[model samples]
Target chain A: MSLLGGGIFKGMAVTLRNFVGSYFYKDRLTTNDYSWRPSDKLPQHAGEYPKEEGEQLRDTTTVTNYSRNFPMLLHDGSEPMDTIRCVACQICERECPPQCIYIEKSTEKKENAGGKPQFYPAKFDIDVSVCMSCQICVEVCPFDAIVMNSQFELSTPDRFGGLLLRRDDLLKSNDYYHNIHPEEAAARDKRIAEEKAAKEAKKKAAAEAARKKAEEKAKADAEASEGTPDIQEDAE
Target chain B: MSLELIRDILVATVPLLLIFPTLFAFTTWLERKALARIQNRIGPNKVGVPLTRYGGRFSLFGLGQPMADGIKMLFKENIVPRDADRLFHLLAPILALIPAMLVLCFLPIDFPWINNIQDSVKAFMLDGAVIFFFAITGLNTLAVFMAGWASRNKYSLLGGMRAIAQMVSYEIPLVLSAVIVVMMVGSLNAAEIANAQAGWNWFIFTPWGLAAFIIFFIAALAETNRSPFDLPEAESEIIAGYFTEYSGFKFALFFLGEYIAMFAISGLAVTLFLGGGAGPGVAALPWLSVIWFLVKIFALIAVMIWLRGTLPRLRVDQLMGFAWKFLLPLSILNIFIAGSALHLLAGGRLAGLDEKQPILRQLMEGANPLVVAGLWIGALLILYVAANGLNQLSRAKVRPREYKYAE
Candidate 1:
């Protein structure tokens, strides 16, 4: 028979070794102090926490490419509102399971990133408190306008007002999107580019077919006139 | 009381207030740091003597964390439930603190502050100091129950009932184990017990004391609601157990009471088994005993913290069964074995030795050295064999768990 309580003593020895090893071996520690991290690697929201000079960064803990919390509106250019891709189709708002997404389509059309005049969302608000982070909004978005953000540090003291994200807060740069989820943003950008290329090819193919059809009709009409003239001459 | 007696009382009591609370604060910091290191994470290094925020000039490894915690606790709102019994709710924490603090008087630690050693010894000495210590410590359970019952929350009530059940079950084994030492000492006085194990003649050197000490330590862990025996304060299941409703300074008071109780209990264990303040070089400098005593107490506390990190909480049934089935019976058997061993040792030159004298002293007084050696070996063999037999008997039905996932 095995010694009783031997497992406990063994476990104690392991923990003791770990406790001592952690002090000497830096690699033993899984997480280091984030404040010691360089300012560039600091997150965008780090300014809210206590940081040194030029350390206006967010808490970058637990943030990774695969991590997703809530939906954010993506804009291509520096100007978030002007270059916004959302046409206010209300697809995500309608498809939202919790009905947490609120959108108001602008009456007047505005020039989007594609230089096409489109109805932008006049008011976009998402109640993050109600959001289950199912990414359904991301899935249903047609214009590639909405995507999941990796910033999970969304705890707020104000339930209604604080958690309810406004249009400005929802608007994030494509570069910021790339930084948060590089592979996803890259794949999405490639897909949108491929769709634009396919649409151009389809339009060119249709224009070539229309021109060829017009030429054939003209040729047939000319041939018919010549045949009628030849019959008249034969009658004379 | 006369002026000299009042001075003497203040002299005896004031240092306990000063030393233990300070030690309590330091122990909190130490526990966090040690546990963090054990788990391979840096703990509480943020709050320190920060000369400049983000400067990293002189971060003193979060030494200021305990001070900061105290300040935060002081500033927090003392929230009380609306439907709660307000009077008992208020009194529960106070009651917890009193028994914990009161039992500190019974440990036979001799501080150097007292110029006259006789008066100081008198303060710690009582005819039934060990029994009185146990009686007062039992009141800690009442405070726990009071807090649990007063809150009127279902979790709190559940926690209180658990505290009652666990404490009651463990107290038997706890007392029975200590009974070995008291039987060996032939007196219930705390001072006599400490003095009995003078020098390296610690009761733990004996086979029965070893068994009893181990049993006592386990029971003490349960008694203090420490981890592995921390079913009452099962954080995930019952929230924070009885103290779920308590917050602010009242919660802090509970925390303080728990640590002080830890110190008090560890102190008792040292007195009973480890030879109270009986380290080497005590003869050269008398003040070293106080330091040695504190060191031994800290050692036990350190092990408690380590075990907390190492062991998972025992299931409620296992906790009760282990106490009743294993520790209780073994401790009961341990007392008998210890008594018979003492009788066996009291032969040859020790035959005429005074009965009131400690068994160790009587043995040391020119008993056959070979007989003493044989007795040690024989007693150890007997206890070990009996313990193994009991283990096999108790665990007869507890079949080894069969895993389906992998071989």
Candidate 2:
């Protein structure tokens, strides 16, 4: 019923189309020439990549929104320590599958971004060599403090010192996060805002309920005092 | 041995020796570029002219990559196993190169200098060049086996055995398919076959030749170890097969020999099917035949590269079955069809027409156009149905693949 060797022609056709299409269609050729300098898409928020060959981040990337590698701590202001979101609860450290995260809670509390006294990590280190890039730490963090970073050019000569990323290296601005992962960062921010609004509403309701209870208690006391006076009158 | 005889030989042969190796180098670059393009990736575009690496300046589209590769291969350490057969290991690559080089002489390229050379002195212009080509080409198998045996490694031995099994199996169909051309031309000489197809009278225009060409091309792919049939050197299975133990210039020689073999086979294909050196502008400029021949050879090589990029290497059993059960039967049927077509369409020509005249010309000149057309159509139909029937018969009964470990 079928033509013999027809499949070969069909396969050859597909390859021929691919061979021809690649020259005309830009998207077909996805590889970026890494040897070339800064693609315009880069330096959006991270600044110019290091000029040195060894320290240079990949100047061009086809990294999409969901592409993630390693975990980084998020902050909002001029100083990372002052505006950091992590309260050093060690929740991520406990939940990490690979046990790559290391955190030491500060002896004293400090004022965080929310104006709440929170314990910051005195020592936060992520052994990138050990980290599996599973994003479990991202999932476990309750404070929205840690998120996956797509910056994969983390190679270093000194395996111990270089791969064990410190607090300073892990800390990245929220703006940089939004720049790299716009949709996800925006959604996270909106979720946090909604939770804050709900908390404020809950606090207001609790205060109103407390005020109503106090008013009822005071009225009951006044009525009892009035009933006692009436009893005295009756006695006289 | 005399000076004039030596001169005449050099005139005929030296260009072949020089031109093909250079083409081999360029073909390496071409294959990489083509395969990369097929995969939608840039290949070898970084290594351009030397001293251009500073500040990431100047890339000449990676043309220098082949030269760089050649230099690296030359300088690399020639490591041999202590237990290896040192003599054969050293000789295997040399042995591989010799036959591939020898077969190049058999191609009917019509090189320009041949006009001045004496007919007796021209070794390539042989009475049985076609047969000689097949005979010499089979020697590559021996070289492959030698390389494998000499290496004293299990993987190399496996590769060598696979190569022998594959090449021997495929060569049957390869030669069988060509027998149709030889039959039609009434000559085993490469030059005669090429001459028979002059002025767009390619034998492939006939239904039988079409079938034989396809069969020949497939067998050629297996014979040369081109992919989809490259089980002998299946890197995943045998770690580069027979060449696993070879390194440095010895390895380079093997690589060179393989590419030259590819070129030689492609040239033969052009001679047999595509009307060897028969192209436009050849009538006016005789030298253009050589160029056209090389161009056609490159076209086939390009297809080989494209197929290599597209198809996965075949399993050994599947490879053998396809060659033996599928291709062998099909090629045999093709020969039968060609004999019948010749009898039906050009019966008188086969018996009494001048043998020197092209078969296509004789058939056309002697017969009515409508009768010829009807016979050609009928022949094509019969060949197609027979091929389809063969395809159905040879297909494996298994519907889907079952992995033993995964399940």
Candidate 3:
């Protein structure tokens, strides 16, 4: 009832609890073991990090997917032509608030299967000094060409030379994207697959119509040879 | 010097030289590790490792961190300010360190099994060690002032002033609390005081002794310039305090003095309250005294570290007010109460009781243990309530803060 020295005792109890709890209650301690051999908690790497909240803080470090630092270009990973997702539409280049993005559209004529001259980034640059990592560029990119990278360790001695990242430095494979953000990568993969399937279906329909027309024409010619009437009346 | 005298000198100095550095090193390690644990992190597990080939699996832990720190300090440049008083600046740390080391002389850490060499078991003992300890430790104020003033910096000067103020103010409560123990024990010798508290006869068990221990402990925190009372070296406010200009081994010496003082004061507290080197096995195997002494010292240090981790630094004004108005009064009253209670418990005469009997035993024999304990506990509770009431009455009549909420 007197409350005399009670606060001091309460504080001491709290600290003592934490000190003991750190050993047993894995979540109380935020220290990574940093061992050489792989552990059950972290099998892949010596220092296993937590990717989500309320997980064990002991023997672990946390990595947040949404810690947007620098921008990176995503290149699709399948076969002969590893496609650059960026159509070089220059939408991100236009929408970037800091004007850090400098994109030069490819001048060379390179046609795809559809006979459309596909544009690629000939010289893409992002001056990280000016870039605020607002993620507006990634958001505005219609083709999902750009995504924010979580690699924050971009320190360099040569400030001006090191910070101005080029297309080569910005490029990351789709596999890497999946490793960092699996859900986002899965959705993007499904969307791309659907688009490809729809294109294939349209092509097949057009080919079928053309083949049928040729067969009809051949039949009409045969009829003419046999002194039978006209093919113009077949429209109805 | 005679050969016998020289041997005697070596016996005293040789062991101490080895022991003090080792104590300082381990204390630092203990502090870092304990603080880290309290703050929910791993600390200093990498420095002592011999090989990194196997990384964490096979490598040694960071136990050699203090050695690394010492080596680093040795190589660093000793910087002296351009306009500083160079003589005092150099001498201050040495001055500060001497008293800390001197206090260890009075402490009887081990009670030996061999009867012939019993006197030599301790480093040395003085007739009035408690008085000597207070006198020597008081000189630390002068050393701090010298360091601060010699640095020729405003922040250093300010820190030095605060150090003196806090030390002087807290000395009253520190001395008063110990005085109560002295009153009960009726001796000035450190060894005698410790002997008074035999197995389980520790002062901490009794109500008045517990009150005195708490007061002494708080005062000790201030005396050693530990956190919650570390205003003199508050890094956030003033950079490095009085030793701002010091570098290299000079700064390390200042640091060494601080830790040694912490051990010294805690050792004194152990002697006063926790029954120094007195344990169950100590009677049969007297060598256990060393182990018991170390265990108690480290336990006290751990508590200090826990406090450091838990409590925020007290503001300068709050620190001063708490010492002067709160701790000072409480300690003085505790002394009075301890004296009167002892008298009452002894049937109104302190002389007729059996001297060998512990106060707890005496009280239990005089009355029932339960009744005596209950009465003492009740008295403490009443004191607490009265103290709280007094504090309220002292505050200026601004309607209590709770009234504002009502309005």
Candidate 4:
């Protein structure tokens, strides 16, 4: 009858409701399952795999994508030709707020498209303990060489060795990136495709111009020869 | 000291010793898991393995957590304060457990209904077991005082004082509520009191009995220092209360004592109001009595856990006031109502249609259900009006505050 104890009962009723609802209702259960296994029917589009019938699914693609704090090196191309995207540009190193990244250009030279030699990083080390995970390195990388990684289980017992991630340790496959951040990975792939198309178009235009110049030169040479023969006949 | 006597004593007490501690541990696990559910989280399911991980699968939960905790406690260094009274400090936790164990012995569990086995195998039979149970439980207050005083800490001292005040105040209502049942049965023996409510005559069916049960239950909560009434050991208020100076195994002992006491009191409530183990088929299948008794206790304990999960701790003054001002009067009035109702209806037949009669006869002539129900309804109406009046009286004393706006 009194309002004094009514609030307690209301609170108790709320707890009871939660206790029951937790068992029967999926939405009511607030535990964030940290299991890494993705469900088979997870809103996966036609990527490289086919779906089976009536798979237990989760709409993970629609849900919030995991934020990548630590930066990692992207390994470009497949197997034998695979090269580190980083060309020792030093942009990410300079822009890094915490100055955790270290880069050393290689003494040996590798041929570029123009036949000039270019240097790649011989030593790349990230003292991850000092990294603030602010994503400045990822943003500053002009070559699209560095990107933030979503793998957050970086706990290490070793202070010096474990925390200091080397170039090999930081290298991740493009497939790995696509799996974690599909939207970003797709956007990057589209941009790369556009760039390749533009480069091919430029090469074709240059070849056509070269052919026209060569033809004109050939005609001029014939004309000069004809003029030389005429002068000889006149002199005779 | 004879071999037969020794065997008889062992038969009575061996199960109590083995079962209660294990139940207490399981209760702790259950409470944690249930509370986590109420809060919408997965509780402790990562601690222990049920079996070997075969074929990359295992059905493991934190079942071994209590055992692990016991082992950890055993290996821990028991720390005592530099300025503490070493002797009392050492003895305090042990003292706390003693009364709790003693109280368990007084409970009359699994006494068969049909079999005229007057002296069935039981732990201990005291004529005034209800009184003895309360008295032994009361000694836990002294243990709290010892722990508080010996610790030489301010928080411990405050907790000890609060424990004394809370336990003493709540014990009155708790005992008074039980007194109504004792009055109805006209015997101090727990077995007689239980037998009096045989078949469908469970005291909980009556209005006065229900009111007494509620009062007794709430008081019991305070008495056991459960949440909402657990001001003495309130973490935000006092460190660890009376057990502030205790560490390791000593702290474990205090914990064991508190949980065991919670269960024992709940068991007492079942015995007094819920007709002990007198359920259908319990007489024929005597072993079923244990199951029924345990089920009732577990239900009551679940309610306790629910209360813990739901309500926040009461403030010191509110705790004391509720015990004295509210519960005491309610229980006293409940006793009076039950007494009068018993006298007017059924012509003061203290036996409740003769306990010796068969179940069918007891059901047919047991205290005229209509007249008993009518009396209870009348009493409930009176209680309702009284509660409403008191509510108004309390509200009238408070002055309303006025607010002014600044221009």
CA error at residue B271 for candidate 2, angstroms = 1.8
lDDT of 2 by residue, A1-236 (tens): 34455666788788888788888899987666556375554433233333446556542222367768888999989799999999999999999988998999999999998788989999999999999999988998899999988886777899899999999999999998887788899999999999999988887777667666655655676676755322111110
Better of 1 and 2 by DockQ: 1
Q: What is the TM-score, restricted to chain A, for candidate 4?
A: 0.67
For each candidate, report its DockQ versus the true two-chain complex.
Answer: 0.62, 0.48, 0.57, 0.49
Candidate 1 reaches a DockQ of 0.62
C-alpha RMSD for every candidate: 5.9, 6.4, 6.3, 7.5
C-alpha RMSD between model 1 and the true structure: 5.9
Model 4 agreement with the true structure over A34-110: per-residue lDDT tens digits: 33334654433223122334343321232125466578888755541146667788998899898999998888877
lDDT of model 2 at position B57: 48
Per residue, candidate 1 scores C-alpha lDDT tens digits across A1-236 of 66777788999999999999997887887564655444555443422233565644342432355667788899999888899999999999899999999999999999988888999999999999999999999988889999988666666779899999999999998998888788788999999999989988887777666556655655565576655322111110
lDDT of 3 by residue, B83-152 (tens): 9999999999999898998888777776342233335434446768999999999999999999999999
State in Å the error of residue B256, model 2. 2.1
Poorly placed runs, candidate 3 (over 4 Å): A37-69, A76-82, A85-87, A112-115, A128-130, A149-164, A193-236, B50-61, B111-123, B345-386, B393-407
Report the backbone clash tally of model 3.
Answer: 2
Clashes of 1: 4
Per-residue lDDT of model 1, residues B255-344, tens digit only: 999999999999999999999998999989988888899999999999999999999998888888888888888888888888777777
Lowest-sum lDDT 10-residue window in model 2 chain B = B50-59
What TM-score goes with each of the models?
A: 0.81, 0.81, 0.81, 0.80
Docking class of 1: medium
- Runs off by more than 4 Å, candidate 4: A1-6, A32-66, A78-82, A105-116, A173-176, A192-236, B46-62, B111-124, B243-245, B346-371, B391-407
lDDT of 2 by residue, B11-44 (tens): 8888889999999988999999998888888888
